[model samples]
Target chain A: MAETVSAGASGGVLGGRRSRQEAAWGYLLIAPVMLGFAVFFLIALGASFYLSFNKWDMLTSPVFNGLDNYRDVWRDGEFREALVNTLAITIPHIVLRLICAMGLAMALNSNIRFRSFYRMLFFLPVLTMPVAIGTIWKWLYDPAFGPINSFLRRFGLPEPEWLSNPRTAIAAVVIVLLWSGVGYDMVIYLAGLQTIPREYYEAASLDGAGAWQRFRDVTLPLLTPTIFFLSVIGIIYSLQVFDLVYVMTRIDQTNQLPTVVYYIYEEGFRNFRMGYAISVAWVLLLMILVFTFIQFRLQRRWVNYV
Target chain B: MVPKFSTRVNRRSLLGAAGGASALALTGMLPKIGSAQDASAVEPYNGEEVTITYGFWDMAQEAAITAQLEAFKVHFPAITVEPQIVPWGDYWTKLQTSLSGGESFDVFWINSASLPVYASAGALLPIDAVVGDGGVDLANFAVPLVEMYGWEGVQYGIPRDFDTIALFYNKDIFDAAGVAYPDDTWTWETFRTVSEQLTDADAGIWGAGLQTSWQENYYNFIYQNGGQLLSEDLSTSVVDSPEASEAFVYLTGFFADELTPTIAIQQSNPVADTLFPAGNVAMLPGGSFRAGTYGQADANIDVAPLPQGKERATVTHGLANVIWSGGANPGAALELVKWLAGEEAETILGESGATVPAHAGLQQPWLDANPDMNLQVFIDALEYAHKVPDPVVGFEWQIKIQEVVIEGFAGNIPAEEIGAQAAAAANEVL
Candidate 1:
């Protein structure tokens, strides 16, 4: 009887040792990643945060300036203009992108001929490089020789100076912004649409609902999670628009459409005010954070999940 | 149960400690963290083989430059040359970032507008020592071109080429209009009348480009009309003067009368060369560098002295070769910069038919090479040439002034308002 008790105890000990080994393996697997984050990302964040407080021109030794950069950034009119431009361009861009992406995704979700080929065509813009697209679109936005104006002229429409005119410059940039982003968003929405059960649509149809009615009741509610996801992501991304403005507009063409990132670049790189640029970067971070918070707060009201 | 929990914790802690150790080592190894001091050290040139990277952007002149570099290698048999080309629009941004990050090339080209900003930041090595230490003979270069490379008596670069804007006219258009070819005696009024006589709006051809470019247009007019951009002390704006306004009006008057294309038209079709080459424009104020560019084009063009305004002045902009402060080889880099700015490189550049050298002794060779063209207009304009005034202590004020000029050309506001706007912007920087 004592031997039997001893055997049972040993068996228990062996099982415990095996479970402990498995747990240790799991922790070991994740340890490298955690360490990587600590070493690279955490340290970089701390360094930038410290630099944001101090005045450094990258060549001279850093001096502790104690929020002077922030003070100057607050008083800067160019920063304010950039902030306004960022919001002006981003809001319409996000709205149009969401609508266009959802509309295309819905259309693509249906049984259509050459669906794969259509997907490839739609995905072409996503695959194309941003710099190349920016250059090509810059030419297309040319008021005289561009196809945009030529197309408008065919319909007897007055061609507004697309890039050169301050009034229409932001709008023209938005067109390219939407054109570039909608493809990626549509592909994401298409993937989300595929996961949704077809039974929900059938059930809605059995209840005497029309296609639009079904979409409003079933498709939209199910797609809410994806739309919410894209909304938050698109807002975050559009707020940091540097390449679009840099390529579309000349650097010397000031006062019309300087995006927040471009403004930071001009301040930091061109103007050699690194401390001020860091402060501006911090402000951008705060703005993005607030926007992200608002999205998260609003998501509870609309976002649905199975 | 206690033994099991203790074993799991022990294993977790062990794994974590190992990761923590490795992580510390890895972070210590990142380029920015480890390479700052290493960047300052010059690598010894191995006798086996060596390569120096030369960064440039003008793809249009790549063939000529390649030939020049090939010739340079023949002189320095120990070194191999590699050319790195970035497009113009992205060149400054890329070069600036790389230099700041200590990833710069051994040698690259620099421009006057951006030199001060880089020099002030210590991003560039001051060349005064190198030039003073018998590495280069500064006396061979034009004094004005050499002065442009220095800030407050500290030299940072050597002149690569000096260019002054001159009037380039379509010979065909001049013949058709029955107008006398532009000569040294030509005045602003003569330029205006010839433009009006040559203009045919119905044919979609303008007599003059009247380009919105600040370098070619208003800045030249401002100086030639006896107005200055700043006070003699460089402390205040004089652009709001009556003389300045008169100059602005005279330039924009052609646009107002539809004799020259509006800023809107030029902005949309930025083919200053294309229009002139296609015989759509009778005259354009372009530089000697562009003379070579148009020579290769379909245009049967001839050069003439710029139309004399009140003062016979023209804007002179030049290119330079600046060595970065922390390049892998300051010695070799300095030698390369000096050679490129010296008679050797200038003669090769002239023979290659690229641009006129800023080296005084090298001018005749370039003029002789382009004997078919009126190359003397460039050399004569150098007498009236002026560099864009240096900016305020930290910022590049030229960019700000150009911004205002572009605003005027875009017709964002009235032409008269542009001067005041420009003055305010300049004061903001000052």
Candidate 2:
């Protein structure tokens, strides 16, 4: 018992001293990253929460204005429009991302030619920076001079204003979002597809299941866990879409495809209404938490451990 | 000890006072601050070596700005100056964050639209401490610009350069279309008629390449038509006025008539950087700042005064170099600001043809840099140049106005509705 008690800090017997030194080494090794997290992430998180209830313009010290920022957010026409845009972006992005990722995963799962080449080709967008992707896409979407409109015009097809028109802008943005985001989900789906037992598909086939039936019964249920993961991740990421829209859709200060995160950025940084921006951020956090929570709860119904 | 404590107190309170417009009465309201020569028996600069950062937005002006910084080193060998170049899009946001973080650049270029915001926040140091005998004088610079940088009678900045509106016509585009080159005698009606003549719908060539931009495009027309964006006190917006409406209609008609490149095309091919340089447009109503850019463009272009509306008027805006109050070294920063205001540095700015120097009678180098083009048209317009209203509330309304204007130029908003919607947008902020 005394020896066990010696496991505590400082100036003990040889064994205890060794263990203590090891513990000290352990803490010393982690101290830099831990200190960094505490300073940057945790402190910033706390400060953001604190700033939510204030009227701070960054230039001045914060003035506590209670629930006014939150109250005003409820009626903020811009916020509502942004939230709707977020939903529009998220739903299409999630649905399309999952479908495309699953299709690609299944295609790759088969013994195909140039398998690694195709995989790398598909995964390249995920590796590329969003800003780079946005800039390239912005050029592609340029109305009069872009290759896309030129292609359409060559065929005498009516080319719609891709980034500027309100009617087509969101859809145009979501298409690019899908192109950039689907690759990450596809790689995850491919890993999940490989994890499923080959015997399950064999058993379904032996039980008179066709290719369609085998896929529906064996592959679909097994991939539910992967689907569940991508859904939650897709919802979180798409809900907070910023850089792509910022680079691609903005015309000076006017954001053509305004999303919630972009709105938060504009309010805090551009407008210098940081207190109000933080409140919107907190609302978005709460929304993401609720969505993730609901997804977790719903996953219990359909996600098969088997 | 007492003097040091009082100086610190004055600085702290000055920052607080500068944070609000209500404090902008007179510097006399606050005690004389910063390097008050007589107040300290001790030395302010002990020949200390300090490295200070200078923030500015224009990459086009970087060459000239670097030349100025190189000169600054010669003047004060101990003070190593660094240029912190942020693009115009990100400059304000970064400046605001850097200030609040207490890691701001020592000196930076500030436009008039943003001066009131920064000055009111006390983020700037009054160079008045450096503005006496044997130091810089306020009278040497452009008077309106000197006033533009002043907050409550304490000047926060020294004017670096000013720009006035001019019509830059591509001689190639004009020649191709068999259209007469624009002259000072041209009026708004003539501009419209020339635009009609120059436009070839079957080809991609446009008659004009005007943007819904504030300074370069509409603001000139609005001022020319005798309109004001806001009332004198800035208590309300007067965008609904008939004069403003007329200007909006006249400018939007170019887009409505499909004479200029659509806003959609301009999004990718900005007028200054691409379209005008590419010679897709016959004429461009742009700022004098574009002279450097156009001077280097592959196309042959010459500038004329903006065509007369109700009266021949243009929008004149200037940039001023300011010292950040929150910087690590204020005294060293003050030395740099003093040198920047001197004629030698201003000469480099002019000679580089980056911009027209705000130092009176320094326009010769910029004009000579592009002798073939009518660069003097920019200087002559300064006689009738108008200042854009900087509202006490903020500049967000200008963004709002520009949004409505973009909508108008895109043909999304009807010509008649442009005024009401734009007025409503400004009213929201004002």
Candidate 3:
């Protein structure tokens, strides 16, 4: 009986040693990945935080100047204009994208012929580079030679300036943004549509519902979760829209399309006020946080999941 | 007995080693040792390979500039010139970052718009000592162009090329309208009349294309109207003066009168040069540096001096070859800069038929290179030309003007208000 107990204790010790060896192997495999993130990304975040507090003009040594940068930003009239412009653009852009993307996704989900071709056509804008898209669309919206004006002229219509006119410039940019962005949301919604059981639609139809009624009762409710997900992502992206606006608008104009991020660029690079630019960046971060939080709170009521 | 023997062995080995080392050190100190043998093993390099890179934003004339660089290499076989060519729109942003980072190129082109800001920041290496030591005289280049490179009586760079605007008219349009060709003596009234006659609505062509472009359009007219962007002290707005307002009102009147295309039309087909070439515009106010481009165009083009107003003035600007600070081998970089700015480099650029070299001696060759058209208008405009004003930060004024003018041309506000708007914005920037 004593010999048996000794054998069992030795076997337990051996098993414990094997488990410890396996745990060591797991940690060794993941060590490189963990080290890479700590070294590159986390280090960058720490450096960015420090840089945001100091003033550095590339060639000279950086100077620490407390929150003077924040004060200067608060006083800048252009910064105020940029903030308003950015909100004006982002709010409308998010609304339009959500409506159009959901509408197109629902329509395309129906038993439609040449469905994939239609999807590919809408997705083409997403694939094209922003610069190339801006160039091509700039020509199309040209008040003189563009087809848009030509079509207007044929109908005895007065051609409004699409671009180059300050009043209409922001609207034109929004149109381009929606045209380029809606397809991405549509693809996401399409994936969400596939997950909804077909029997839900059949049951609604059996209740003698029309198309719009069916959609109002079934499609939109089920698509709310996707709608919520896309809204969060879209709002975040539109708040930081730089390339499209930068490429579409002429560089010399100030009020035309001065998105908040572009304002930061103009101050930091063109004016060489790095400290002030960082202050503006931090303000934008706060604005984004507030906006994201609001969307999250709103999502609880409407974004339903099975 | 064995353990005691092992311990004894260890003690003997340690003491024996220490005593041998001490004896060798004492012996080495007693006699002369040849350190020369060690020094020969690690010799400093006498002939080292060095590379100097340059960044520029003249993509439009890159081919000709490349040819000029190749000729520069013939004189100095030791240095290789590497060029980083970026587009003009993106150039200043990258240049500002590179300069501030102290990782800038050895040589690059500097513009008046951003030069003072860089100078104040000490991003440029003062080339005075290098220019004097290298014995490259500046008198051979155009005096005004050379002066653009200096600030506070210190030379910072060598002017590479100079440009001024001249009237580029489509000969076909003049012939079709039965109007006489514009000459040096032409006034603004005469220019307006010719433009009015040349415009044919049925044919989808305008008489003249007046760019809403700040410098190319209103600024040129402002100088002609006896107005300046700023006072001599660079502290206040001269833009809101009666003369500057009159200049802007006069130019935009063409749009109001339908003599020139609307801002919408011009923006749709943005390139002013393309419009004149394609017969959509009868005449264009374009820079003389575009002589090669006009010469190569399919249409027959003629060049004339800019029309006069209260004063005869055309915008003249010079591109300078500047050496950046904080280079590892500044000595070698200075040699390359001096050579490139010399007569040989200028001659090569002139002979390539690309640009009018900054050197005064190379002017005739540059004119002769283009045999088809009379290229002498550029030289003639030099008499009436004034350099574009140099501000502390150049792009600030440009951005302000563009913003103000867009509202003016859009008819949102009176063109008369443009001066006041521009003045207020520019003063803020200043």
| Tens digits of per-residue lDDT for model 2, A261-293 | 999998998777999999999999999999999
Instruction: Compose the digit string of candidate 1's lDDT tens values, residues B103-176.
Output: 77768887876676667666676666557555677887777788778876778788878888888888877787
Per-residue accuracy of model 3 over A143-211 as CA lDDT, tens digit each: 878898899999999887877665577788888989999999999999998888989989989999898
Clashing pairs in 1: none
Query: What DockQ do the predictions score, one after another?
Result: 0.25, 0.23, 0.22
Give the alpha-carbon lDDT of every model. 0.75, 0.82, 0.75
Cα deviation of B361, candidate 2, in Å: 1.1
- Winning model by DockQ: 1
Error of 3 at B76 (Å): 1.6
CAPRI class of candidate 1: acceptable
RMSD of each: 5.8, 8.3, 11.8
Worst 10 residues of 1 chain B by lDDT: B30-39
Q: What are the chain B TM-scores of all models? A: 0.87, 0.89, 0.85
Off by over 4 Å in 2: A1-29, B1-46, B132-134
Where does candidate 2 chain B have its weakest 10-residue lDDT segment?
Answer: B33-42
Model 1 TM:
0.86
Q: State the TM-score for model 3.
A: 0.88
TM-scores of all predicted structures: 0.86, 0.91, 0.88
